[model samples]
Target: MAGAPIYSKADLARAETYKARDYPANVDPAIETLVREMMSGFADKWTVTILDTLWDSGTLRFSELARQVTGISQKMLTQTLRRMQRDGLVVRTLYPSVPPKVEYTLSPLGMTLGAAFCNVWIWALENHKAVDDARARFDEAE
Candidate 1:
């Protein structure tokens, strides 16, 4: 082909390094379960939102977090926090006071997850206009 790109030997090796991996013939079931659990946490919008909010606003009390997250119900927030705690993403602290105050903060693993998601948030903000334009064109075409 006249316009086809040509790759040097070094370019071919670099491209090979970037290629996707294939699982071995005897794959471990535990690895699959772990990946499934990780994907579920990443797929949940509420989980990501809570993590992002916590990442931005240090440690916050339950009421403060609820307010910051916006649109999250008390019950749903409670559930999400519990699930995050189980996954070792968030830490919950209880103060033995007259009213019994409770606070939440991201754990070390949660901080890492938040850092990874920051890139995604940045990409979304940068590409939102293009995405909206594409959606409009598609809608107009239909």
Candidate 2:
């Protein structure tokens, strides 16, 4: 932990810009319900991983996607892709040829979602050490 990298103060300040300044007194129930549903969907680790991979790699074949997203089983990847496709997050292209060809890419909707979540990735990068130190302290106290 001693050699852990630390982000510059400017970087931290930039990250803070994304935080909500204030909330309206009145909230719409329908909007709150939609937000909750989306949060739960994005909460899946595999879903996030797949989104990041596709965002970086553009279009990728099924097997290649599996290779890029390490630790995801074929079954899990298939299920995650199915859910993503169903939710209009990814565009799956099927080519009719020998053995059949398929590729997955982020739809325009998915790209926007990826952009929205980019802030979360930046936050994690900046605060990972603080999180680790907190965990270490908590563990030692136990």
Candidate 3:
């Protein structure tokens, strides 16, 4: 850890200013905590996939979403949806019926998240070949 690069917030802010991009000099603790929590939640594959599916397909029932998100077990889907709902990333609706009727859609908060993730999709599309080649080289070396 001795040789590890040490960067201060000032340094980061300076770098951002050099690039003419906005950087918060004083980040609020609450906002930082929320960002960390949301990032941790979105780090998983299923959550990201579910977000993408919902973004593309709009409102969908549980079974429909399950089918769209291939390879996710019903239990896993249920758990993921529950987490998303709890996190305010998804909205769930239930209607009275003989059995039951339920649907899921992205909340306003979730739509903002989806928009933010669009930048990630753009980055992946731009750098996928470079990433793939790097992985292949690393595998060969290993």
Q: What is the lDDT of residue 108 in candidate 3?
A: 100
Question: Which model, 2 or 3, shows the larger TM-score?
Answer: 3
Best by TM-score: 3
**How do the residues 1-142 of candidate 2 rate in per-residue lDDT, one tens digit apiece?**
7544455797578668756557777889998997898788888899999999999999999999999999999999999999999989999999999999999999999999999889888879977888897677767666
lDDT of 2 at 125: 93
Minimal lDDT window, size 10, model 3: 1-10
Candidate 2 residue-wise lDDT at 12: 77
Which 10-residue window in model 1 sums to the lowest lDDT? 1-10
Per-residue C-alpha lDDT of model 3 across residues 1-142, encoded as one tens digit per residue: 4333445687578678878967688999999999899889888889999999999999999999999999999999999999999999999999899679899999999999999999999979966876686677667666
Candidate 1 regions with alpha-carbon error over 4 angstroms: 1-28
Pairs clashing within candidate 3: none
Candidate with the larger TM-score of 1 and 3: 3
TM-score of 3: 0.78
lDDT for 20 in candidate 1 is 46
Q: Model 1, range 1-142, lDDT digits (tens) per residue?
A: 5324444687577668767457487879999898799888778778988998999998999999999989999999999999999999999999999798999999999999899988988979966876686677667666
Candidate 2 minimal-lDDT segment of 10 residues: 2-11
